[model samples]
Target: MGIPGGSAPSTRLLLLPGTLGAGLIGLSLWLGLSHGTPLRCFSGVAVGLCFVSAGIAAWRLRPRSRTGPWMALLGLVVLTSHLNDGLMLPTSMSGRELITLFGTPANWLQVPVAELLFLAYPSGRLRTTAERRLVTGAFALGAVAAMVMLATKTPVPICGGWCGPSPLQLVADPQLYLRLRSVFMTGTVVLAAAALALLIRRGIRSTPRQRRLLRLITLAAGLTVLLFAATQLFIVAVYTGRTGITPTVFLFETLTSWLAAITLPLAFLAGLLRQRLAFASVGTLVGRLEHVAANTVEAALAETLRDPTLRVAFPTEQGWIDVSGHLFHPPSDGSQLLTPLGDPPVAVLVHDPSLSEDRQLLDAAATAVRLSLENARLHAQVQAQLTEVRASRQRIATAADTERQRLERDLHDGAQQRLLGIGLTLGLLRNRVRGTTGRRLVDELERELCTAIGELRDLAHGIRPAVLTDQGLAPALAGLARRSGICVHLDVQVTERLDPLVEITAYYVVSEALQNIVKHADRADACVRAVHRAGWLVVEISDEGPGGATTASSSGLSGLADRVTAVGGQLQITSPPCGGTHLRAELPCA
Candidate 1:
C-alpha cells in the first residue's frame, strides 16, 4: 500500500465515486421518507454517507490501497439495499418483478462487501492466504444464498407491513427458505468473529507506532462484530420463539449496529490522519536538522522523533563511535532499533523500535543525518590538512633560522678575523717603509681594510643578531632601537622565557616592521611594544608613515606575515588612508 504523503491523487478520480455515492444517498433518503420513520431513515443515511466520505478521503490519502474503494462500495450497497425494500410500493406486477430480480442479489451483497472491508481494514489488502480464502468463500456463499432466495423465497416484508411476491420463485417451500436464511445468518456471525480474531492478533504483534495508528479502527471493528453477532442471535431467537424479545431490545440492538457502522469509517479516517500527522513531523525534523550543529544532530533527531534515547554513531576502524569520536556500544538486547543512515551504512541511529514502522520518517531523517556526517568528516579532514601544513612550515622556518645563525658565526669568526689581521700587517708596513710614497700606499691599504672589516661586521649582524641570541628579546630590541637612524621607543613586558620559535618570530616581526618604517616613512619615529597575555605573545609596531600599507603591496610585510602564520600566529596590518601604520602579531608563547 502507498504510504501517507504519497503522490497526489487526481481530483476527478476521487470526485467520480464521491458523486455516485452522494446520488445514491440522496435517492435512498427520498425513498426512506415513504418506507421508514424519519429518525431511522436519517440514521441509515448518516452511516452510508460517513462511509462514502471517509472512503473518498482514504482514497486520496493512499491511492494504491483498495480500502477506499471497498468502503465506498459497501456504502453504495447499503444505500441500494434500502432502496430495494422501498421498491415494494410499486403496484405494477412487472415493475415489482424487476425490483425483486435485482434487489434480492443486492441485499445479499452487503454481507460479502462488509466481510471484504473488515478483512482489508487499514491497509486494504487481504494480507494472508487465510484472509484471502475467507473473503472468497464469503462472496461465493453470499452469491449462492442470494440466488437460492431469489428462486425459492416468496416475498419480503417492508416497513408498515407492506409485502410483494417474488415473481421468480422456483420453489414453493417456505420452510426450506427459512432454514437457509438461518444458516446464512449464522455464517455471517462466524465470519465476523474470525475477522475480529485476525485484527486482535495483528494488534498484539504491532510495534508502538502501529498500535497507535490501529487503536481506533480496531476498537470500531470489535464493536461492530459484537453488535452484528448480537443482532443475528436476537433475530434467530425471535424466529425460534426462544424468548420474549421486547420491541425496546430490538430497537436498541438496531440502533447500536447502525452506530457501530457509522464509527467504522470515522475510525479509519482518524487513523489515516494520525499517520499523516506523524509523517508531517518528519518534515519539521528536516528543518530542525538544517540549523543544528553536527555534534548535536543526535539530540535534535531524538526530540523530533520523540525518542529520548536516540543515539547517532558512525562505523570507524577503531569500532563504533559517536559524532564526537567517543566509543559507543550499540544496543543488542532487543529493546531498541538500529537504523542505518546510508545505502552502504555510513552511520547508524539507535532509537526506539516503534519508529521502524514509519519508514518515510526514518528515510527522511537518514538522508539528513548522512549529509551531516559527511559534512563533519570533510570538515575534520580540512582541519587536519591545515594543521600539517602549518607544522611543516614552522619546521622549515626553524631550520632556516638555524642556518642563518651558522652563517653569521662564519662571517664574524673567519672573514672578519682575516681582514683584521691584514689591517695589522698594513700598519707595521707603513712604519717600516718611512719613504713618502711607500707610507702613503701603506696608510691607504690600512684605511681600506678597516672599512671592509666594519662593513663585514654589519653584514654578520644583519644576517642573525648575536645580541638577540645572548640577551633575549628585550635587550636585543633595545640595541636595535639604539642603532636606528630614526628615533625609536621600545617596551617589553615579558618576564618569562618563551619557546625559541615564538621568540624568533616576534623578533622578526619587530625587525621587519622597523625596517619598513625607516625605508618608507622618511625618518618617522616608531614605537614597538611586546606583552605576554593568556599564553600568547602580542607584539605591536606603529610608525607615523603614510597609511595605505598592505601585504599585497609590500613583499617584506607579505613574507613577514607568512612567517607569523607558519608559527601558528596572526599578523594584521592596519594602515589607514591619511596617517600612521600599525602592525600587530599575536604568536602562541606556550
Candidate 2:
C-alpha cells in the first residue's frame, strides 16, 4: 500500500487504520470546538471508518484480496485534510501556509486513490497496461494542477480554511492558475469517468463471483460521481449569479457529495465482512447439506461459498454424469475447477476456478456434503458391477470355447474310434460265418456302425470344426458354405489370422447366417462376406428373400449381439418387408 511494488502484509494484524482513525476523530473535534470552527466530526468518522474497515479486511484477508489498505490510506488522507480545514490554532507561518496548500493537494491525492481503487478494485494489480497508464495520467494531471493552484490565487478555491497566505505567490500568476485549474478540473472529471466506465466494463465481463465483488464498488463510485457533478453545477450557478440556485439546495448538494465519497469504503467493507462470515460458516453448511434435496445441493453450495456457479456431478460406469443423469465430459477449458471427492473421483464439484486453491474449504465442504456421496457410491457400485459383468462375459465365452473343444475331442477320441473298431470286427466275423442269416446279421451290424460314425462326425463339426482349427477362417467358412442346405457364396479377404476370439466370432457369424438363411429364407442363395479393415474384422451376410427380419430379443441373434458387444464389437441386422435381409457385425482388434 505504501508503494506499487510494496511487499504484502506479513501479518493479519490491522490496528493501524483503527488507531489513525480514532486519533483523527479526536483531533477534528478538539480543533472544531477550541477554535470556534464548523464541526462535521460525525461525517469525518464515517469516512475514517470506511478506510479502517476496508484496511482491516484487506490485511486479514490478504490471500483473498489486497485492495484493503489502499482504502484505509485514502481515508487517512481525507481525514487529515478535513482536520486541517477547521483548525484555527496559531502555529508556525510555514506550517499554516503548508496547510493552506494541503487542502487542494490532499484532495488531489484522492484522484489517484479513486483511479487505483477502480483500476485494481478486488485485486491490487491493474488488469492491463492501458488501465495502469490511465491511473498514471490521472495522477499526473491532478498533481500538476494542484501545484499550479497552490502557487497562485485563482478563482478556483484551493483551501476550505479561512486563514491562508500563499508561500509561492512571488513566483505565481493568476492567469496561469486559472488555466491550470480548468485543465485539472476537466482532466480529473474525464479520467474519473473513464475509470468508472472501465470498472463497469470489467464487471460485465466477469463471472458470477467476480461480478459480485464489482457491483457494490460500482454503485458507490457511480453515486459519488453524480453527487460531485451536482455540487459543481450548483456552485457554478451561484457564483455566476443564477437566481434559481438557493442556499438550501446548495447545502443539500454539498452534503450529498460527502455521502458519495464515503459510500465506496462502506460498500467494500460490507461485502468483505459478508464474505468472511460465509467462509467461517462452513461447519453450519455441513448440516445443511445433510437435509438438502438432490437438486438443491448446488444452490446450497453457492450460498455457503458465495459462488453461484458451483455444480455437483457424479461419476458413472460409462463416464461422468450431472445431477439430472445426463452424460458430461468436462473439456480442456480452464475457467472452472473440478474437485474430486474420492479415488477415481466418485463425485466432482465444478466451481469458480480460483476457489480450487482454497483446498481446506473445498475439502471440508466435500466431506460435509455426504448426501452427494451417497448418490456417488451408488454410481460407483454400478460402475464396479459393469466392470465385473464384462469380465464375466469374457470368461463365459472362453468356457464355451473350451467345452466345444472338449466335445470335439471326445467325439474323435472316445466314440469314433470305438465305433470304427466294432465295424471292423463285424466285417471279419461276417467272412467267417457259414449260414445266410448269421452272415446278413453281421453285415447289418457293420452298416449300422458306419451310419453312427457318420452322424458323430457331423455333430463334432457342428460343435467346433477340425477344419477351423487346422486351416483357419477362410477354409472354415468354405466348409460351412458346403454344409449349408441353401446355396452360399463365401467371400473372405483376410489372409492373416486374427485373434482366436475374432476368428471364432467370424466363423460362427457365417455358420449362424447360413443356418438362419436355410431355415427362414426358404432356400434363398446367401452371400457371406468377411473383411478386415481399419482395425476391425467385419462380417456381412445378405440374402435375397421375402424379409421382415430383426434382431429379436429371444432369438439366437440376440445372444450373438451380446457376445459381440462383450468383445468390444457390435452387431446390426437390416430387414424390411420385401427388402433383402442383411446382417452385419464388427469386432475391434485395436
**TM-score winner:** 2
Cα lDDT of model 2 by residue, 1-590, tens digit = 22112245555346667677778777667666655344455565566566666666555555455567777777777777665543443344335666556666776777687678766866566877778889989878877876776666433333334535455654445446545555566667778788888888877877888777777888877776666556555544544446354566535544653664566656656655654576567778876766776656667777777787787777766777666555667755876888888786768888886465355567766777765666545654555566667768877887888788888999999999999888888878987999999988887888888889999999998888887877888889987888787788878998887777778877877777777777777879999899998999999999988778777732878777887877778898888878978989998877
Candidates' TM-scores? 0.54, 0.55
Q: For residue 493, what is the lDDT in candidate 2?
A: 91
lDDT at 421 for candidate 2?
88
Tens digits of lDDT, candidate 1, 215-273: 87678778778877887787666545576546755465556547656777777767666
Each prediction's whole-model lDDT (CA): 0.75, 0.70
Which candidate should be chosen as best, given lDDT against the real structure?
Answer: 1
Candidate 2 backbone collisions, by pair: none
lDDT of 2 at 501: 73
